[model samples]
Target: MVFVQYTVLGIFFLMELCALAAFSYWGFHLNRGWFIKILLGIGAPLLVAIFWGTFIAPKASIPVSIPVRIILQLIIFALAIAALYFSSKSMLAVVFLVVVVVEMIIMYSMGW
Candidate 1:
């Protein structure tokens, strides 16, 4: 059970990494000018970091109830998956979504 907890935590970390990567990928591949690309490449992930720090991190500044937190997590992960799918990586998006669902189920069932 402890091992499962640690594994779920690791999954959370991986999910965060995937979100940042998806945001970066979307920003950098914008069909706009180089300046816009650079701005978005930095700005998008910065915005997500701010949001996560404020509302979703372990030490969130403004923490919500567990249900709300889980909902927020799902929304964020869904966006990341959508980003991947729209960026022409549908298979990867599906895989990421599957992994996220499994992690969420385990976390919830284990009361993490």
Candidate 2:
């Protein structure tokens, strides 16, 4: 089960990388703004964080400390909403929203 999970996640990450690469290429070709690129970079880790916390970590036997976890969750959520609230462009907000959604999805999935 662990091996299968790893394989699936590996593929998912690879897909994300490919999408990032394509975005980079498109950015270079079209000269999209810097914020857009940065937003894309942020999305990658956020996705992993969300996936692991939600889909993977809960199955582990040991209990994670709730207070610290809650703090971290709030931080991510704030970043997501903050990016939207502060900025005019869609890319930043969208990227952060993706992160926020991923985090929430995992938390919800694990019944946290």
Candidate 3:
């Protein structure tokens, strides 16, 4: 039973990480262009969340519903992805990565 809990959170952890990576490393921020910002800010993480949770996270028994969990996950993950998309340099990317890590930590530890 304990293993199941850890496994579920672990799956969420990695999915969160990928969202972080997509935003932080691939297609993060978008201050320069409005349309692109909307594209990455909303699209990338939504698609990734659906794909990752559907295909991979199930191995750990995470929820398949997009509406599950706190609203913050959607906001944070999507924003992180957007930030990653628009980031002009590695520093910004790293900041977004740190944000995701911190958010995950708080969610896991105390729902802090």
Candidate 4:
């Protein structure tokens, strides 16, 4: 049970990484100038990372209730799914959504 718990946590961390990658992928694929592309590709994930570290990380600087944290997490993951879908990766988006849903369910059930 402990192993499963830690594994789920690890998967959650990977999901966060995937979200950043999704943002970068979307930004780079935008039909815009190189400057804009570079700015967004790097900046989007940076902003997300800052936000996560500030409010959503395990040892967040500004902690909230579990419900609020979960809501924020869902919002971020939703944005990542949208990014993947808009970037012509609908299948990947769906798969990501499924994994996110399962992870959230397990986390909530396990009180993680």
Best by lDDT: 4
Query: How many collisions per candidate?
Result: 0, 1, 14, 0
Best by TM-score: 4
In model 1, state the lDDT of residue 69.
90
**Predictions in order: lDDT:** 0.88, 0.50, 0.58, 0.97
lDDT of 3: 0.58
Off by over 4 Å in 4: none
**Over all chains combined, what TM-score does candidate 1 have?**
0.94
Runs in model 3 with CA error above 4 Å? 1-28, 59-112
Worst 10 residues of 2 by lDDT: 22-31
TM-score of 2: 0.34
lDDT (Cα, tens digit) per residue for candidate 2, span 51-105: 4466334463444576655555555445435444443435755665565456455
Measured on C-alpha atoms, candidate 4 has an lDDT of 0.97
lDDT score at residue 1, model 4, on the 0-100 scale: 92
Q: What does each candidate score in C-alpha RMSD?
A: 1.0, 9.1, 9.9, 0.5
* Candidate 4 TM-score, true structure as reference: 0.98
lDDT ranking, high to low: 4, 1, 3, 2
